[model samples]
Target: MLKVIYILLCILGTFLPYSQFLPFVLEHGFDIRLFFEQLFANRISGFFGMDVIISSLVLWVFVFWEGTRLKMQNLWVYIASNLLVGVSLGLPLFLLMRQFQLEQQTDTAIS
Candidate 1:
């Protein structure tokens, strides 16, 4: 359940860039007025890069939380890896934790 929510969040995070780009693309497609309206209506789009950074940080926190919750053997390793990837990739880290949760769930179910 939580894993599913994380997966969905990851999917939504991946789509964020596209959502930000939509207004620009719409303007290029010659709907300038509508584009500006849509763009400003969602003021957050004006700070897409910042939004991505914040989202990445939030994702990293989620990863850390999950790692600590599961008490995995290499919890620090996972945390460090997620921190590095989160900073370097400038992308949300939710996918990594989501994958971990899915694997953990599967392993438990199998046992």
Candidate 2:
């Protein structure tokens, strides 16, 4: 049930953000300057932007530490997902993988 929810979240995480972002790319053709201009255009937007930046850094550190501790492979995949999308994709994805790994460990221990 938890895995199912995580999978659903992953689908949502990818779809929701890209749904908003793709149109921007189409309109601006990857205009980084304009992107930043609009992102920090107001206090609320700036707050969200700064929050995301801090969250991303924290996610990176968590991905490294916990992922390494669990011997999870392909840690870069989480970082790449984070870069390509955001925590929306990365967090749920990592949780899904972590759940799978934990399940595997449980099975191994039982066997």
Candidate 3:
């Protein structure tokens, strides 16, 4: 049930943000460096951007360690999703998947 909630939230969150981003992408055409430059152009955005990036980096390291320890497949998929989408979607999505794996393991162990 909690996994379902995470999945739903991931879908909705990704959709809403990306929908708003579509027009911006059409105008800007996928320039990452330029995006970073503009993102840090202001003091406020700079602080927030740096905060998000550092947090994301830390999360990625932890995800890699734990995912490997748990032998969870598609770990790279989560990383790719993080890169392609955003942490808001990827983090919960990874948690959803991790929960699914745990549920399966528990069921199998019980059986």
- Per TM-score, the best of the predicted structures is 2
The candidate scoring highest on lDDT is 2
Alpha carbon lDDT at 7, candidate 3: 85
Each model's lDDT comes to: 0.56, 0.96, 0.83
Model 1 alpha-carbon drift over 4 Å, by segment: 1-46, 73-102
Worst 10 residues of 2 by lDDT: 51-60
Q: Root-mean-square deviation of each candidate, in angstroms?
A: 8.7, 0.6, 1.6
Give the TM-score of each candidate: 0.36, 0.98, 0.88
Candidate 3's C-alpha runs over 4 A off are: none
Per-residue lDDT of model 3, residues 36-73, tens digit only:
88879999989988887886787698779888887898
lDDT of 2 by residue, 30-98 (tens): 999999999999999999999988999999999999999989999999999999999999999999999
